[model samples]
Target: MLAWTALLVAIVVSFRPTVPVIWGDTPPFVESALLTLETGRPTVAGGRDPGYPALLAVTVAFGGDLSTVVRLQQAAWAVLMLALAATAQTATRNAAGLVPIILVALYPGLLLFRHVLTADLLFAVFLNLAAAGLLVANCAGRTARCCAVAAAVLCAAVAACLRSQGMLVPIATVLVGACVARPDTPARVAVIALSVAAALALLAAGSRFGASDSDQSSTVFLPKTLFCNHLNIVLASDAARREIVSAAGDRADATMARLAADFAAEPGRWPVLGFFGDACLFDAALDRDVADDTGNAVGAASAYRSIFLAAVRDRPLAYAGKFVHQMAYGASVAWPPYGLEPAIPVSTDDVPLVSDIITRHGRAAEPIDLQGGPVRIGLLSDLPGISAYLFKALSTAFVIAVLFWAVTAVWRRRPEFSARAGIVVVMWAASIVTAAGAHTLDVWRYLVPAVPMVSLMLSLCAVELAACLRRD
Candidate 1:
């Protein structure tokens, strides 16, 4: 009942009139959906998986505006996520089932994005539902097991259709399920065979469809061209080329150039170094508009690549140094809410009370021109005091502890429960690794799916802790 109430409140709050107008991936998703509805093709300026757009298109076909339908769908999914959380709590025998409900309800990021037409919310919802099903299968083996496994696989496939990263969830689920199932049992074999066949069928279908289309081809979907084509595009760009050339020029003019270059370097390392440098320069350049006199965006991209490559060949160490620097810059946490607030004031004293009001109400705060917009004021930005530090430290510690406990539980026992839990952890970890590798680590929003998993794990840990206490 508490979970239901929390979910209801979340639904109400998510649809509040005063919610801020924040720029999220929702706009792109909406555009994609609209485009698909009109053109019979999935195309957006920024690359995206077609699943959510296609879903939206179906909803529009039934008679509704893109934004309205998508927002309604998002709200519905948010509620579903809450119910799944409750289910996870029951399945894991965790007393803290309400934790997922509360955390999700109160999280500013989740609240802000919950009703937005973006793939993240949809991906999270499907992923969590699949996770809940996997947990159920782990706990009970029979027809329920078969149903749970099938549900998990199907949901995971739906998730993957939205975001390529989601493919990891289904793959991880199948592997974990197989490992936990009794060896040579008919059920186990059936589960394994079904999952493997499903995956292969999806891949083959994707390949066939992809081959038929020329303009709509993505290297990401093709196994053979994936890495090379992606790398080639990055290197061939003018931005990277220019950076390479500029770096090479700097090396040629430097005194004792021969003495400076004493290291044995692989030819391949040069391109990698150039690629990293070009990527950094591209990111920095994007921060501000370049001079109009300098060629168009495409030309500039090509020039940047040339400069980047030249730099790599001339002074390998210096190029390598830039790569390390870029990685560090990319890895470091800049701020909690990326682009949430434009200027990070040393203190929020002078900011109007309207700003405060907007922070609370978010987009719902009336009058688009109001001082307070649905802009998030970070706790780090607002309260620099020890209290803020303590709260953050505790929250971080709790999350970390939950993760550690989950990892230990999975490692210590090869139980069915642990196997299912391990898959969730692995998927979360993979998302993190992918984000980190791509140098796109910005907001906690990216880690939203991990929240339910963490909550579920913590609830399980709490139950175990209570059991131990009772025994003692």
Candidate 2:
């Protein structure tokens, strides 16, 4: 009853981005969906991940309503929150489920990604499901443990397919579960290892099934290309630049030199080094049309990889410093509510927001808009004054809660719950590093995955604290 009420309330309160949110990376996904529907094959293009597009195609095929899609997505997220809440309650064996469910349903920042056309909403759901599955597996009886582990791995595998960074989720799940399991439990270890291997195999199969067959294809996904691009900026010192040029040889030396010059003119621009700069070195590298008809995107990616590897090989310290800064930057402004295009009001005279929801090809991205007007949560957009303060306060509280749980659990020698806490900390840190490593910019949307993890884990900590107090 509480879960259903929360889902309905969340649907009503955070019903912004009702029209399919389309922008920069959205076209490829939309195109992929259309192609999938038309060709009856799970075809991926434009370096976009195929998981979300394929899902979108399949969903639309059944109902043909994008609004229905958003509602279903929100409900799915709500269901995951309910599951997480239930898991946390079971893990602590306490009356602490309601708070986590409420927090998840009411998270102001969650509103940002809920109804979008991106994979983030689904990615986050899968990750939380995996976390919940691990927690359940940790507490399950011997016979049920194996099944729980399998379910967790399946969730992690789906998460990985949705986004590249998700590949780490299965590993994290196994480690978190193992940490919580009884000592000398080799059977548990075997189960987890088998699950991890199965998940990896599934990911490999998904990639092959979704791979683009274009000869000029980079043969690599957009995520990896973006990653290599970020690495290119990290390797932008004069020595590194010269090394890259030398490595590229005459055929590509000029292009590499030009990129170096661009980096040199504004060092901060490449890695998004400073607080603010338009240093999209990564995007620029992606745009360098060095590939001909016979070329694979892999070759271009290889060039960037070579330079990045050489830089790390030659100057380890530089890489470390940049990496740390990038991670810090990523962690700083994780989930600001209104960064992705501040809500523009639709005047009676202006074009409807529904008409504007199409792709660059002018193809119908959302086909149908169920809402009357633009779905703008006015309080978020109009009053940016409190958003930062609220974000900071909540972020600080979450961090402190995580730290408190970690120290207390270690001091108490309580591995069961602490293992889950540790997983949260590690996953959050890992996500920050992944974002820092992959993107040139430090945008808040990039940290969407961390938001729910932090919230759910912190809520679990609160429950554990309650359990501890009760025992005392």
Q: Which candidate is the best by lDDT?
A: 2
Find the candidate with the highest TM-score and give its number: 2
Predicted structure 1, TM vs. truth: 0.61
Error in Å for residue 412 of model 1: 3.1
Clashes of 1: 41
- Model 2: lDDT to the true structure: 0.60
Candidate 2 lDDT over 167-194, as tens digits, reads 6666776666655553256676677677
Candidate 2, which ten residues in sequence have the lowest lDDT sum?
Answer: 345-354
Error of 2 at 401 (Å): 2.2
Worst lDDT run of 10 residues, candidate 1, spans 255-264
Clashes of each: 41, 4
